[model samples]
Target: MTAEVQSVDIASPIDVISEPVILTYFETLNAGDFQATADLFAESGVLRPPFDEELVGREAIAQYLAAEAKGMKFQPLMATYGVLETGDTEFTITGKVQTALFGVNVAWNFVLNPDSQILSVQIKLLAGLEELLNLKPGQDKKKE
Candidate 1:
């Protein structure tokens, strides 16, 4: 499924996001460990995508992720651009994402329960690719 288009302030300064849970989320996804990824969430956790239907509960979330992993081919190059501490247990992470098809900016808003389990996650699309997917903004042009 295609993600909804989003608008982001690209000029905002990007800060390094070094959250362990965030890192594990990406790592598990990239590794194609759908169950492991779902295990990171709380039993009744929710996964909200930019375009697709929301998946709630561990079983539903795992099933969705498993299906996506089976269907999609590309792995994204994701870089954390910023993060906001929305509350004591809630945070939002903004990042630049690139894959074989296109590049996009995205945000992952997460809520964690007392046990550090992810209680909910909302994935938002921020923007589409403006430059070539393989060439990051400041990179030099390839020699002819």
Candidate 2:
């Protein structure tokens, strides 16, 4: 009789991610502390959007925030809805944002460094973003 070894898969996706840092992100964003939110990322961090060009560096991120704040008349009342672990160092954060216009669900894909600093964040929409923002596909609110 011969003994055989079996391999098991460990790359399973987790349903909920309890990261305090992620919670802080929403808190800072809701507080209108754009600079503090940018500081949560690493020095060379990048913010990628679904339709717009990628923004890199703290300064660029700050400029983007400033432009958006000026253009948009409302801010969302956001709360973390759930999280999904996608990879060893990556996860997707899902949230519900309630605005005056409408309520929308959004997803944020985050890649973190060893030090817990965010390396990149890709923003995605699950529902109601377009109609609520009153924009078309590929249209930028920053231009308003």
Top candidate when judged by lDDT against the true structure:
1
Encode model 2's per-residue lDDT on 1-144: one tens digit a residue.
113322222222122344556656666666777787788889999998667899998888878866663322222223232222432256566554444434445677777666778788888767565565674443332445
Q: Residue 21 error for model 2, in Å?
A: 2.1
Q: Name the runs in model 1 displaced over 4 angstroms.
A: 1-18, 69-88, 128-144
User: TM-score for each prediction?
Assistant: 0.63, 0.62
**lDDT scores for all predictions?**
0.63, 0.60
Candidate 1 TM-score, C-alpha based: 0.63
Q: Write the per-residue lDDT of candidate 1 for residues 1-144, one digit (tens) a residue.
A: 112322333343222334566567767776778898899998889999877999999899989889765433222233332222433266566665544444456677777765678888888777544544455543443456
- Model 2 regions lying over 4 Å from their true place: 1-17, 69-88, 128-144
Which pairs clash (backbone N, Cα, C closer than 3 Å) in model 2?
Answer: none
